[model samples]
Target: MIELTDNAATELKSIIDKEEKKDHALRIFVAGMGCSGIQYGLALDDDVKEEDVTVESKDIKIVMDSDIVGGLTEAKIDFIDTPQGKGFVIDNPKAASECGSGCQGCQ
Candidate 1:
């Protein structure tokens, strides 16, 4: 199952509160075609499809499509703050694959 770091949860909660989507769930899914395979996507949605797998962390409901669940089994969502700015990142071990450019992987 996917997991969210404390900072990630707090940041997401703040966003939801600001956007007034308290009634909605955070939808995380695979989108686009990454060099390795797939990329991640996040959105605020109220509908839970029949093929979705939902997990609750830090009082936040996170939903993901069954098809993409396996690839995110051990993923961790984290929020990072630097002098430049702050943002969310996913530390997904499953996503650590060779980019086909002779490089080890994108870390």
Candidate 2:
């Protein structure tokens, strides 16, 4: 249940085309850490674990662990290129804080 902007889809396609692995997918996950408790991660993954989930949108396939699916259903993945360089940008509605949201001892 995630959305990828046109720019993001295009950028991701470009990366996938140039990578050593072509059948892999763009993996996005919520990890425990960041200035704000949880940070978003993006990478290329060749396989999905039993707990992982995936959604296809705008010609892009997004893969995430099923455990994080409920909380991140409406997330948005995008790409941004500037003079500084290029990177992936995430917008998750479920994130209480930018990165460090859940209480350390809690989640």
Question: What TM-score fits each model?
Answer: 0.85, 0.79
In order, what lDDT does every prediction score?
Answer: 0.86, 0.79
Name the lDDT value of residue 36 in candidate 2.
55
Candidate 2 C-alpha lDDT tens digits along 5-83? 8999888888888876678888887655655546778888989787788888887777888877787778888888999
Look at candidate 2 and tell me the lDDT of residue 6: 91
* Per-residue error (Å), model 1, residue 47: 1.5
**Winning candidate number (TM-score):** 1
Go through the candidates in order and give the clash count of each.
0, 5
Question: Which residue pairs show backbone clashes in model 2?
Answer: 36-100, 37-99, 37-100, 38-99, 38-100
TM-score of 1: 0.85
Alpha-carbon RMSD of each model: 3.1, 4.0
Error of 1 at 34 (Å): 1.7
